[model samples]
Target: MPDIKCSVTECEYNSDVKCGAPMIQVDHNNVPKSNNSDQTKCDTFRAKG
Candidate 1:
């Protein structure tokens, strides 16, 4: 797969500044639609144990 960069160090799916998941889900943080990066969230994020 192409390199998918990620900066969430606390996520279990993050690997060396990249995403190791087969796929990632990005959803709007609250509103129905997102107009910017800050308005969105990584739904696939899982805290490292």
Candidate 2:
């Protein structure tokens, strides 16, 4: 756990302001290489049921 901070309340892995997933998978969206946070997204995010 890298102590990831999360704010996507709709995600199941979000506990408070921290991520509770065993691990986080983040990758660039569309762009071949991301140069900023806005270009990346969390692949570990699962919608809360």
Candidate 3:
């Protein structure tokens, strides 16, 4: 299988190799609600370290 690169720079899972999981689950509601509905962020994000 091809490697998955994590987009989050703080996540230890993020590496030049691949993401630890085949897929990551993210909740949109977890993101802080903002006036700019177009904006998005992952509240569940955690550094692998």
Q: Over the stretch 1-49, how does candidate 1's per-residue lDDT look in tens digits?
A: 6788999989999889999999888899998988999999999999999
Q: How accurate is candidate 2 locally (lDDT)?
A: 0.89
The lDDT values for all models are: 0.92, 0.89, 0.57
lDDT of 3: 0.57
lDDT for each residue of candidate 2 in 1-49, tens digit (9 for 90 to 100) = 6688788979998888899999788899889999998999999899999
Each prediction's total of clashing residue pairs, residues at least 3 apart in sequence or on different chains, is 0, 0, 0
For model 3 the local lDDT of residue 19 reads 61
Task: Give the TM-score comparing model 2 with the true structure, all chains together.
Answer: 0.90
Best by lDDT: 1
- Residue pairs that clash (backbone atoms under 3 angstroms), model 1: none
Per-candidate TM vs. native? 0.88, 0.90, 0.38
For model 3, give the 10-residue run with minimal summed lDDT: 35-44
- Candidate 1 achieves a global lDDT of 0.92
Displacement of residue 38 (Cα, Å) in model 3 is 5.4
For each of the candidates, the C-alpha root-mean-square deviation to the true structure, in angstroms, is: 1.0, 0.8, 4.6
Query: C-alpha displacement of 9 in model 1, angstroms?
Result: 1.0
Error of 3 at 13 (Å): 1.5
